[model samples]
Target chain A: MAPMRIDQLTPGTVAHIVAIDLDELGERRLREHGLDEGVEVELLHRAAFGADPLAVRVGNACVAMRRSQAAGVTVRVAQRLEAAE
Target chain B: MSEVMTAPVVALVGNPNAGKTSLFNALTGARQKVANYPGVTVERKAGTLTLPDGSRAELIDLPGAHSLEPRSPDEEVTRDVLVGAYAHERVPDAIIAVVDATNLASQLRFVLELKALGRPMVVALNMMDLAERDGFFIDYEALARELALPVIPTVAVRRRGLEAVIAAARDALNAAEISAIRSADAPAMLVEAIGDMRGHQRQARDIAAKVVSGGDANQMTRQIDRLVLHPVSGPVLLAVILFLMFQAVFAWATPFADAIEGAIGWAQGIVMTSLPAGPVRGFLTEGLLGGVGAVIVFLPQIVILFAFILVLEQSGYMTRAAFLMDRLMAGVGLSGRAFIPLLSSFACAIPGIMATRSIADPKDRLTTILIAPLMTCSARLPVYAVIIAAFIPDRTVGGLANMQGLVLFGLYAFGVVGALAAAWVLRLTVTKGAGGGFLMEMPKYQLPAIRDLAIGIWQRAWAFLRRAGTIILVSTMVLWVFASYPKAPDGVSQVDYSIAGRIGAGLEVVFAPIGFNKEISIALVPGMAAREVAVAALGTVYAIDADDEELLEVELADRLRGAWPLPTALAFLAWFVFAPQCISTFAVTRRETNGWRWPIFMFSYLFVMAYLGAGATYWISKWALGG
Candidate 1:
C-alpha cells in the first residue's frame, strides 16, 4: 500500500512523516512546529464541523491544522492504536 | 557589556508555551513596564530583576518565536532584538532560553538556535514538575554537560529553582570572557543550521534522546482531549463556558457597577449642593462627573471579562475554543485565532482591537479589528436599554419570552449578522490577500496561577483606566463647553440656545429621512464620545431634570414615548446597531493599525451601514404601523 497523507490516517494510527509539500510559508510553519521527515505523528481528533482541521500529536505537542495543510504531509503508517484506550 | 555603568540586560526567550511569562512574573513580581516597540505594535515587556547578589538587572521578555527565521511580525521583533538588529533594543548581555521540560524535544530546537548565535546563554528547563508528573526524569546535569551550558530545572508557577536560574544568569552576565566568547566564530555546521529548521530540530532530538530517561504518556491530557475535543461535547462545553462568561459579565458585575455609579452620583450631588450654581458647578457635575463617570462605570465589566479571558488563555483552553470555532470563522475568511479578539469586543472594542496582535496574519488581524465594533459592546447596552424600554411593550410574546427581551436579542443578533457580513465582504474586497492558515499548538491544560492571573488582569484594567482618564476625559470636557456656554436667554431652554444645539439643528436635515427628530440628532453628537452618553444627551436636549438617575430613566422613557413615533424609536435602535459612535474605539483602531487609513475606512463603512439600516427600518415600520 502507498503511504497516505496525514489527514487520511485513522484517528489512532501512528505514522512517520515521509514528505511535506506545501508553499514556502506553510512548509516552514510545519517544520518550525517540529513536523519533518522521519518525525512521528498521531492523528488524535477531528473538529466537529466538517472535520477539516485535524488535531494531531507531533512529538509531545498537539497541533491543530486544516486538512488542506495536512494533505501536504505524506506519512507511512506505523500502527493503529486503539482509540478507546 | 557596551555600557559599563548601566545595569546588565538579560533577555528571556522561549517558545510560546514554555512558561516564559510565568517565570518572568516570578522573577520580577509586580515591577514591570510594558510599552510598544518603536515602529511596530509588538509589546516590549521589561522588568527589574534583583539577582541573588542583591544587584539589579533589566530582564526583558521577548515575544515568542519558533525559530530565528521570521515568519510573522512578532517573530520578526524577536529575531531582530535577539540579533541586535532592532535599533531600539540593545543586544542583551546574557540570554536565558526557557524550555518546557515536558516537551523538551521540540522546544530545545529554539535553545539550540539561540546557542548557534554564540551568545552567553543558559538553559532554564521549565515545567519540570509537569515532566515528573508524566513519569519522566530529565538529567539536567548531563544535558548541561552535553550542551556545554548551565541548565536549571524549574517549576515557574511553584517558584522552584528560580534563584538558581537567576544566579546562573547573573554569573553568565558577569563573566569577563562573555564578550570574547561572542566574538569567537561559531562552528560551520551550527552556522549552517541557523536557518535550517529541520537541522536544529534533529540536533535537538538527538540531545533529548541522550538525557531523557522514561516516558509514561501523559494520560491526563489525552483523556481530557478525548472529551474536550469531541465532535458533540466539545462545542457543547464551549457554549456552556461562553454562556457563563456572558452571565458573569452582566449578572455578577451589576452590583459593582451600581456601587460605582452611586459613588459618582454622590460626588456630583456633593458638588451641586455645596457650591453655588455657576460654571464651576456645571463643570464639576455635568461635564466631569456625567461625562467621565459614564465611561468609568463599564470598568467592572471590562475587568470581569478580562479575568475570564486571562484564565482561559493561561489554562490553555483558548486554543481549543479557537479550534472549535475555526470552521465557523473560516466561513467569513478568518481563522479560529480571531475568535478570542472578537469575543473581547463584546465588552469593549478598544481591548478587542488590541487583542488582534496575537493574530499573526496581518490581513486577518485588520479584518478582525474592522468588525470588532459591530459586536454590540457593553457601551451599546445603555442606548439599547433606553430605546427598548420606550418602544417595545413590557409583555411576554408566545408565552415564553418577554417582548422587550426579544427585541433586544434581535438587535444583538442583527449586529452579529452585520459583523459577519462585513467580514465576508471585507475579505473579498480590500483585505483580500493570501489566505492565512490555522496552524496553532494545543498546549496541555494547566491550572492558572492566581498571582499571574491577577497581574494580567491588573495590567489590562490599568490600560483601560488610562484610556478613560486621557481621551474620554478630554472629549467630555469639550462637549460640556459646547453644550453649556451661550446660556439660554431666560425661558429659551439652555440646550436649544447652546452651540451644540445649533449643530444638532444643522445635522437634523441629513438625519430627517431616517425618522430622527432634532433631539435625536443632538444626542448623536455627544453619542460620538460614547454610545451611552446619548441617553444623557437626550435628557439635556429635552430639558429634563437629571437629579436622580432612576427617575431620569423613567422620565426619559416616558418623554421619548411621547415625542417620537414607533417607527422613529425603532429606527433609532437600528441606527445604533451599526453606528461608529465611540471616539475611543476609533482612536484605538488608528493606534492598533498604526495609521489613519484603516480607521477612516472603518468609520466610513459603519456610517453607511447605520444610515441605510436606520432608513430601511423607518420606512418599513412606517408602512406597517400606518404612521
Candidate 2:
C-alpha cells in the first residue's frame, strides 16, 4: 500500500516515518521524540473505548498520541517480512 | 566546602524515563533541593555529591528532552541552560548525558547534540543491568571512543557504577575550567556547526551499530503491552487498577491513622500535666495539636495513595492510562495530557494544579486548573467519613460491598462527573476552544525501582507534613483567636461570644436555605482553612451547647446522627462536593498562576456551585422524602 498518515495504520502494522506536517509546536515536540523522517515506527495499539490516541513504537520508546496529533506524520507502511516466516 | 573551593556544576540530561532521575538520586543521595528554575515554573533540582578525590561537585538534574530543540517550557529551561542563554543559571561545567542501554539509537543522538555545546561530557549507560538481562551487550568503551566521551555503565536502581560516574564527573570538571566552559561571547551556535539533527541521527545509528553487540526487542514488555493495551481488557484493567487503588487507600491506612491519632492524644496528655491551667497549655492542645493533628491523621491515606501513583508512574503504565482516559476527556474539550493533573486532584488539588505545567497549551492548562478543585481531594475524606459513619447504616450489599463504602465511592464518582462537567462549561466560557493536540511519550516498561518509589513517597509525605506544620498551624492559631476572644460575655459559651461565632451567626441566614444550622455555619468559617476543622468545630459547639464536659470525648458522628435531619446530611455532603472550603487550594492556584485572578474566580464560582448544589440536594431530598 502507498504511504499514509501514521494514524491510518492499524495495530500490528510497521512503518517508517516519511515526514511530519505540523504546526511549530506540534512539529517541535514530535521531532524531539525522535520521530524525524526515515525513523522506523510500529503501530502498537489504540485506546480501549474510543480508539483515538494510538500508541506507536518509535525507536525503543512507546509513544501515545491522538490521531489529530499523529495526522501530521506520514508513514510508509513496512513490507510484511513476517509473511516469509 | 569553601566558597573559594566552589564545587563544579555537572548537568544530568536525557530523554524522559531514561533513568536520569534515578541516577541523580543514586549519585546525590539525600543532598538535593528542588526549586523552580528562577522565573520559570520548571522544577530545578541541584544536589551535592562528594567526588572520589574528596571534593564535592554540584549535580543538576536538567529537565529531560530528546534534543536541545525546545518544545515546552521545561525543555526550554534545559536548552537555555545548555546554551548559556538562561541568565540566572550558570552553564554546567560538565554534562553527564544519561542514555538507556536498550535505546541507544534514539538516546545517542541526544548525546551528540549535548556534545555540540563543546563541554566535557560522558555518557552514563543507565539500566545496563536491564539491557544485559534482556540479552544485549554494549561495547561501552567503543561507544565512548566513537563519541570522544567516556561511557560508564550504571544500574541506578542498585546503586551500581555510581562510584565510576562520580569519578568520571570529577575528572571532567578538573579537566575543564568553569570559566572556560562559559563565555557570553562563545555563541553556542555550535549545534548547527556539528550538523543538523538529521546528520547526527545517522551518526548516532552508525555508532549504535558498532557498539551494540546483540539485542532483541524487550519480549516481556511486548507481552505486557499486549495484555495492558488490548482494547477490551485495557480499559477494564485500568478501571480495576484505579478502583483497587482507592479501595486500598481506605483499607490499608485505617490502622496507621488510628495509631497516629492515639499517639497525638497521648502526647497531649503528657504535655497537659506539665503546663499550668492557662492560655499556653490551651494553645498547645487546641491550636497546635488539635488543628494540625487533624491533618496529620490523614497522612497514612495520602502516603498510600501516592505509593500507587508513584508505582504506576515508574512502571510506565501511567501513559497507557492517559491514552485510555483521553477518549472520554476529549469529548469534554480537554487533551489527554490533563488526565494526570486532574487525577492527582483526587489526592489534593494543589499538586494537581501544579502538575498542569507539563500540558503544552496554556488554554488547556488553565482550563484544567480551573476545574481541578471540583475533584474531591483527600481533605474531604474526613468530612465524608464522619457523615457516612453517622448517617448510613452498616449493611453489605451483594454480600461484598458495604453500604457506607458504596456511598463513599459514589462521592468519588460524583467528583469525577462534576470535574468533567466543569471542564466542559469552563471550556465553553472561560477558555479558548479545547482542541489542543496531545503527544506524550510512553516510556518503555520496567519494574518500578524500589529506591525511586521510596524517594517519591518520602518527598510527597514530607511535602504534606510540611504543609501541616506551616499552613495548617497558622490557620489554626488565627481561628483559635477568632473563637476565643471577648471573654464570652459572662455565663455565655466562649465561641458564642467570639468573632467566629458572630460571623457564623451572620452567615447562618445565607446557609439556612441549604439546611445548615447556626453550628454548621460556625464550623464553615474555620473549615475554610481546612475541611476537617468543621468536624472539630461542630464538636466544640455541641459540647458547649449541651454544657456537658463529657460531650468533648464523644464522637461527633454520633452527635450528628441525632442532630441533623436526613435532608441536611445530604445537603452537607453536596455542599462539600462543590464548596471551595480549603484556602490552601486557592492560595496554590494564586501561586501557580502568578496572580489572584484565577483563585478569586475559582472561589466565587465554587461558592455559587456549592450553594446551588446543596440547595438542590436539600429541597430534592425533602420533596422526595419529606423533611
Candidate 2, superposed: residue stretches over 4 Å from native: A82-85, B1-3, B37-41, B185-187, B190-195, B270-281, B489-491, B535-548
Which ranges in model 1 have alpha carbons more than 4 Å from their true place?
A79-85, B1-4, B176-193, B378-412, B526-570, B582-595, B619-626
Residue A74 displacement in candidate 2 (angstroms) = 3.2
* Candidate 2: clashing pairs of residues: none
Model 2: how far residue B605 lies from native, Å = 2.1
Q: Rate the local accuracy (lDDT) of all candidates.
A: 0.83, 0.81
Q: For model 2, what is the alpha-carbon lDDT of residue B489?
A: 66
True contacts kept of 1: 0.79
Q: What DockQ class does candidate 1 belong to?
A: medium
In every candidate, how many clashes are there? 0, 0
DockQ of each: 0.75, 0.67
